[model samples]
Target: MSDIFNTSIIFKSSIFATPVYGPTTIGNMLWFFIILVLAVIIAKIVSLNLNRFLKDRVRKNDLNLITKAAYWLIFSIGFLTALPNLHVDLSGILVAGGIVGIIIGFAAQSVVANLISGIFLIFEQPLKIGDNVLIEDTLIIVEDIRIFSTIGKTFEGIYVRIPNEKIFTTTITNYVANTARRFEYAVEIRYQDDAARAIQIIEALIEDEPFCLKKPGPSVFVDELAADGVIIKTRIWAPSEVWWDIRTTMLWKIKCALEKDGMEIPFPQRTIWVNLDDGDSTPKKTIPERNHVAEVRIHTCKPSHPALEKSHPNSITAYNGPDESDKE
Candidate 1:
């Protein structure tokens, strides 16, 4: 093994040694630094030129992206170019990098997954900045599309940072992805109410609303026959931005219009029947054990106890205990 190792080292040195020109290796080192500095300066100058040239059309965010990418690219190339000066073989370094990367990958598999997911998201473009979206039913606006995560502002004015992996895997409901969206609602009316008139009233209310889209007009119909009342379904198309306003305003408008049209909104109700001949409501009278050995039974119940009855206020007796003996 030692002979094999020694022979390989000797062979490697001979192959890569090449020829050290001029003085010591210091010249190569110094030259590498000079090239590195020049690269950095050129990268910055080019980035500044782009900024000034597109000053009118470019936003601060765009400029930041341009500058950042340029800086990193320049720095990376400069570092790689300096490798030969340090007497390091590129092939060896690449192989070593591969091995190290594999080892670290086992330790950070999740991180790699997230990075790949983020990359795919940038290209998919399911949602964009300045758009309102519901991710996992949590409503938020796309504040920014970043490299590793998505930044958002919730309806409650809270800032949210969601990982790219979660965003990619979870359902993304982009409200503003399309110009027109269907808003749905159900209005319940009493059984005695006029169904046709109720539908017409809701349709008219939606049509008059300016935010509602005209192409689709508005739709209203009896969608369901519910237990307490009939459910009137209404669906209307509206611009995504004004959806919340239209939804809230339409509710009040529909209810008011129905009332004005003399249509009743059903309330929860029930029916009950009482029978007097079955002895259900009437009570039996019982006298204390007294003269003439009077035998009787009284069924008295507590205010909340349902079927339990007692012979006396504080004394509990079977519901049929004394009543059966009295009959006999």
Candidate 2:
């Protein structure tokens, strides 16, 4: 028993009694450090260069996409390279990440939908920035396109954010997609006035407007006969940007020009008929009804002509006076 103990003691004392580290230990660690540092440096340079390259061409929407992808790629590579230092098993980590990623993906399916939809929007580009669009009947201007959402501005200057997924699902109308837009107005002339003359006057006035596109020729057509007069439909094509301005100013101009051309303005008229029940078997009605021709001493409205105003009817008519008219 003693001999066996002595032999075992001698063997233990003779070899590896004290532990010694070889140079390879530090070399391996240094190599790992160098590799990791080099990987990081390369990743940073690549990310920086990519950012610089894409800074101009990418829209605000693409910003998040590119940045997220770059960050994830760099982090993933760093994590993998640092696995040895952390003593973490990649196989297990990869498996766990796969499982968790799947769960997260399912849980955030709508987010994924929005992301995919936004990607589609980026590619499809149905509406560009500053486009006037009608989405599901709501007027919106494309303020910015985002990775998962679209930012819009309303006519009232209110900002609206819509998810890309929902935006893609809705119907969109782009008003400014084409260069030219149409403006139409229904012009009614008095029933007694000449229809042919009215049409020519309106067309001439429209032609005088520089904003109106002449190639389209400012059409005038006979519209429906309204209750009081003939309705003339006038349509003009103008630049999209000048639609409102042309319509507003041209409408007033057309009215004044037609009035200057002796075009009569129509007013609504209603006639009254009375049937009195009397003691006659023949329908109990008379031609005069009561046999009285009441003269409604028609005081015609003369718009206070420049020639005269009735004195003592009250006060003097308000005008700049004869000298002002002579100046004209």
Candidate 3:
């Protein structure tokens, strides 16, 4: 037992005096390694805790980046603290690192901008995952938000990747951001049909639909008396989640109800009159449906003038308007 203790002491003295690199001895190197190992373990534990804390607060990609950055930051601090034990000059390394950092910053200007913008987006939260948003005229459902870019799927099923800088700078229209939304429709009915009745029918239909919100209610009134028909404007408020379905379904139901009540949409009509060579001043009216050509023919009229009766009693006059085709 005495020999073993003496041998251990001798080994320790030799290790402490042995030079490994520069003025650093084996003992210093061992201490450096021990510090590094401890740093790694501490970094891992801190990162794990940070990840757990931020798991639900931030996006998946953002959480991952934040945890990794934190881990590396702690490890780097530990490494720098343990580096002086080797008796190395850190000033030269710091100067070199500063130069490299400047060079990298200049080289990755856009990348840095995107990263900064992404950080702002995380806090601002203009649009979240699964939000129906329109960014720069491209409508999409946000799938994931990352440090530098955002991933989404368009309504047409096309995948899109948008940079965080652009997303942060541009305007975004989030459809479902509000609890309720409003949609309007300009329904046309025949001029002969009752406008008040049409409005009532639309109001009734809106009342029947459960998705339509009752707080804001609905507005149905005669908006315009157009040439073709009476335009009944209907503005309805509904829950944002089911507003689209209500809009589509309600319009069809309104049409069916109006049609069932003997209300039909009317086509444009114009009246035309032709003067006769005789003393008759009565006018001829012609009403034609849309897309149909009108046939015009003059009828023989009994002449009251005595001189025209001898000259040409069979003479007739006819006037017709040009074919009118309306494109909806």
Candidate 4:
């Protein structure tokens, strides 16, 4: 054992000795290899645990990048620590590395900013992959989270790559982050329709739908009584995962149900009273405004006096003039 341990592989080499391990020999190489292997084993174990811990918390691509970086960082520390045993000097390398690091830092400011932002995102977790989010007024589904950027697909099927820094700094509206979400509908029913009946129908429909949450109970009430119709505001809480579907489908369902129950959405309308007593057939009330102009016919006009008709035989009896309210 002594003969094997005492044998020299590199003849006439400078003796590299440490206080604890005595003079270095060819066996130092063995120790270096052993230390390196131990480092790899430790790094692997740490990375595995980290990946498992972050499996649910972080995005897949981000986790991969994190684990790889952790593995290399641990291995590098072990490599540097072990180098001394092999009689390698690190002072010059560290100096050179410092200079290079400063240069890289200056040149890659945005990259470093993104990396830091990515790290913050991994821990903060404001949004995740598959979450529907509105960032900077653009609504999208998060497709992937990377170290430098995030990939998203818009509702229009356009793919967008957003910088991590932008994502971190901007306001993120994650629609599905919470378990439950609320949506509202402003339904205008005919002014003549029964508001109480409309509310009952809406409440019943919400109760029948499974997606609508019951604890925070739905609200159905007449919000406003406008000139055209009664505005029934309906608010409901549902699971965030199905909120959009419920919002789109439930509105139509509510409309159909109301229509079936003899309720109709009212449009703007007016009943004008003409002053037939006067010579000019001026309306006492203006007609309602609509996209298409409607012809107004005075259904009931007073008969002219026989004496006046005889006196003005060739004169214009009634003049239909435009509305004078605006002019006044």
Candidate 5:
């Protein structure tokens, strides 16, 4: 064991006096280990400080990204420094890595797109965690934003993972983005009902709701003359947090108040008239009785077809038949 420990090897034109393995000396190996340990310690310290600095100013996702980038950067620098100390050549490795990087870039276009889009989202801050948003047809509450995807918990209590690229490219409606939101409802009443009375009822109901805003005030007006009734449109503003609650509750209240006041909400209706007898008729003929004998005759004719008249002894004809010359 002593001989093995004391064994010496020499290579021509080597820089180190003693060789542990290949061209590397024991001292160099020790130094490399020390550098690696130092790298880890420094990386941890830098990451903690970076997290602290970014905690208040940036989103959690962005903070995490910065911290990870810091740690990796420090570790990579340390690794490159140690590699030089160990006499490793990186020229061929860098060339190979460049070629591989190009192939990977082509293969992972979508992945790269998502990553870049996620970075932009973090910087833009269009939405945050716990925000209610409508993306296209999906309504969701944001749960987490990651580098490649965004996680959302839907109103139905289901978790959804959307790629960052899709989120960045689509239209996003953030319900909680503003402090106040407006809601409109069209209430219909019978055409005979008083429009002013219905409007007053709706305005009163909106005023009673605590969530409704007063500075901008609520609006009520006749919107249109519908077939069944008059449309009274009501517009109100409320705090975003309670907008939905106020909208639903106030509509019910308005409807109940209108009904209680004898306002009618008319349904679709139609009217039709019919005649019992055929409407087409010619002038009537009156006969004078000479020998105390009176007789009356009745005839009916349709517009499409005329009926033949019965001959009376003292009757007068109102219509003359077509002339023979006219027929020819």
Candidate 6:
């Protein structure tokens, strides 16, 4: 046991005396720490300069990425230079690291894809922080953009975390990208009401709104003639910030104005007709009864105009007279 102890003490002393590149024993370790400190300081300086240089060229979202990359690059060079001084073989370590990296790459392929997409997003600047956007049918306000994911606050006041890969591939509607937005509505009025008068009323209503833009002007026209009424279409442009407010309020205002003008918004209307004997002086069918019951046939026809009949030969016209059988 004494001999083994003596051998261990000799081995340790030999190691302590041997020079590892430069200073031996504890001195070399202290120097290594000092070199690391210097590396940190140099990395910080490089990062600061890189940030300053890219301040104008790059977007604010990419500033952090650029500085982080600069710092890591400088730090890695310093680490590699100091690594040889440690007197340890690094070939095996490098090989093992490569193998581990390959395994991780296969295991976390999606994570890597998200990271790459995040980088593209920061550079492209399709959306910035605090922008209102619609993604996957959800309207949200962007909060923070990270390397792997983006965070958003939904209109419902909930936080949503979307992977950068998904965001990059999906369609994003940026509502605030443009200064102005358009809104349209179809106002229905009775066929008896004058369409020209209705249009004039709507134009006046739109002109009165402060948010509505005048240069482009508002459009009010008869768009369609339906079975029940005429559809008056109104289209107007407004600032994006006030688009929602204007859209919600203008409709009610128009409704009130039209009603005050005695214009009626019509509902579905249908007309029916019945045939009776006028010569009998009683409400009874003229046709002969078969087996103690009168045989009667009914026909339906849609009311049409001369203009419509000229355009559509097959269109059914209004009932003109009773059928030949009833006449007989």
Across residues 214-304, which tens digit of lDDT does each residue of candidate 4 receive? 9799999999988778999999999999998999999999999999999988755545544555676664564534432133222112234
Q: Report the alpha-carbon TM-score of model 6 versus the true structure.
A: 0.59
Q: Order of all candidates by TM-score, from best down to worst?
A: 4, 3, 5, 1, 6, 2
lDDT of 5 at 319: 35
lDDT for each candidate structure: 0.73, 0.72, 0.81, 0.80, 0.77, 0.77
Which of the predicted structures, 2 or 3, would earn the higher lDDT when compared with the native?
3
Per-residue lDDT of 7-63 in model 1, one digit per residue for the tens? Answer: 556645643444465432545666578778988887888778877887788655456
Relative to the unseen true structure, what is the C-alpha lDDT of residue 53 in candidate 4, on a scale of 0 to 100?
100
Q: Residue-wise lDDT of candidate 6 within 1-328, one digit each (tens)?
A: 9998985576467555566655445444544666777888999998898889989998665677678878888888777777655654589778998999889889999998999999899889788887899988878998888889999999889999999999999999998778898989999997778899989988998888889999678899999998768999999999988888999999999889898998877755543332243454544333222221211211133233343346543333444455664456
Query: Which is the winner by lDDT between candidate 3 and candidate 5?
Result: 3
Report the alpha-carbon TM-score of model 2 versus the true structure: 0.57
Q: What is the lDDT of residue 211 in candidate 6?
A: 91
Off by over 4 Å in 3: 1-98, 271-328
Summed backbone clashes in each candidate are 0, 0, 0, 0, 0, 0
Give the winner by TM-score.
Answer: 4
Judging by lDDT, tell me the better candidate of 1 and 4: 4
Pairs of colliding residues, candidate 3: none
Give me the runs in candidate 1 sitting further than 4 Å from their true place. 1-92, 133-139, 271-328
- Give the TM-scores of the predictions, in the order they appear: 0.60, 0.57, 0.65, 0.66, 0.61, 0.59
Model 4: lDDT of residue 29:
69
When sorted by lDDT, best at the front, the candidate numbers are 3, 4, 6, 5, 1, 2
lDDT of 2: 0.72
Count of clashing pairs, candidate 5: 0
